[model samples]
Target: MMSDRLFVYGTLMRGYDHPMARLLSSNAEFLGTASIPGRLYLMRHYPALVPSEDPDEHVHGEVFRLHRVDEVLAQLDDYEGCGPSDQRSEYRREISQVTLDGGTELDAFVYYFNWDVARLPRIVSGRFQPEAFSG
Candidate 1:
C-alpha cells in the first residue's frame, strides 16, 4: 500500500512535546520540519493556520508518512468532529505542497482547520496552548 503522507507541524512531531501526541503513534515518520509561508499561532493543544497578510510569515511543522491512512483519517475525523461525513467540519483534509526545514518542498495530505468554524481567536494573536482541542 502506498503510505499515506501528511504534514504535522505542532504536537504530532516526534518528541511529541504536545499532549495530543497520545492521539498518534511515535513510529510515524518525522520526515522533517517544514514551514508554510503563512502566519501560525497557538491555540488550545494545537496551532492555528491563517492566511498571512505578511509575505514572510511562516507556519512550522513536520511531514509524516502514515501507515494506514483510512483508519487514521477516520480517527482524525472523529477528533475534529468531522462526523466521517461532514464536509463543513473545521478540519478539512487536503493535499498540498509542504516545505521542509531546509526548503525542500514535498507533496502531502494535511488536515487543516477552517479558522472561522474553529470559534477560537486567531492563534498568532491569542497565544493559547492546550493539550487537546475539543470544539
Candidate 2:
C-alpha cells in the first residue's frame, strides 16, 4: 500500500523558514521526531541522507502525514530536484522504515542522496544544523 508519510531531515524540517517547509507545515500533520538508519552529510545549505548499515548510525528528522499527498509530493519532488523532468536528480524519494521517539515504527518516504558522498563531510551527529552553513 502507498504511504502518505514523509521523513524530512534537512531544510524541509520544522523550525526552518524555508518556503517549502511552510508548504509542508500547512499541508501535513507533524507526527513527531523520528530517526532512520542512515548518515547525514552536509551539502552546502542543506543536508543529505545516505543509508548506513551500522546499527549506531542514524539520521534524525521529523515525520509527517501528508494531507494532500499528490499535490504536496508534486511540489516537493520539484523542490528536492527529483521530479520527472529533472534529468539528473540529486535525490531520490524512497520508502523506508523510521522509528519515532515514542518507539513506533512506520514506513515513510525519504529523500536520499543519489550521488557519491565520498568527498562530503559527514554530519557525525546525524542531525542537520543550519548554523553549520552560516558564513
Candidate 3:
C-alpha cells in the first residue's frame, strides 16, 4: 500500500468538530466515505478502531489521499499518542482495505487502538458522529 492514503474515523472524520479534521481537510484529498471490518469503541472523548473478526460488522469512516504522508502522520501520531518506538503507544498505524460508498475497495493506513477494550462501549451502528454523542 502507498503511504499517501489514510482511513480516518472519529475526530479525524470531516464535520467532526475537531482540529485534526480541519488540519487534514486542508492538506489531504478527501477521497470519500468508506468502511472497513472493525469495531468502533467510545473511548472517553474520542474513539478507537479495533479490527473485527466478524465479517458483517463494519466501521464507517472517511478515506483521504494524502499529499504529505510524513507531515500528516507526524501530527496524527501525536494526537493519537503514538510514538515511533514506544510500545506503550495508544494506537498503531496499519494498512487495511476500506470499501467506499460505491463498493470500491482500497488499501489505506488505519490507526488501530493498542489498548484493552474490556470496558469501552461498542458503537453498534459502526459509525461515530460527534453531534450524536456530544453533550
- Tens-place lDDT per residue, model 1, 11-105, is 56666554445555543556776766555555565676654557566666777776667777677666655543676676676677778878788
Best model per lDDT: 2
Cα lDDT tens digits for candidate 3, 28-126: 999999999999998887788899989999999999998888898899889899876888889999888999999998899999999998899988888
TM-scores across all candidates?
0.69, 0.95, 0.94
| Alpha-carbon shift of residue 100 in model 1 (angstroms) | 0.7
lDDT of 1 at 80: 57
Model 2 Cα RMSD, Å?
1.4
On TM-score, the candidate that comes out on top is: 2
Question: What local lDDT score does residue 75 receive in model 2, on the 0 to 100 scale?
Answer: 97
In candidate 3, residue 126 scores what lDDT?
A: 89
Off-target runs (Cα >4 Å) in candidate 1 are: 1-3, 17-23, 51-54, 83-87, 117-135
TM-score of 3: 0.94
Number of clashes recorded per candidate: 3, 0, 0
Q: Which residue pairs clash within candidate 3?
A: none
* Candidate 2 residue lDDT tens string, 1-135: 579999999999999999999999999999999999999998887898999999999999999999999899999998998855564689998899999999999999999998889999889999998986789
For candidate 3, the per-residue lDDT at 109 reads 92
* Model 3 weakest lDDT span, ten residues long: 9-18
TM-score of 1: 0.69
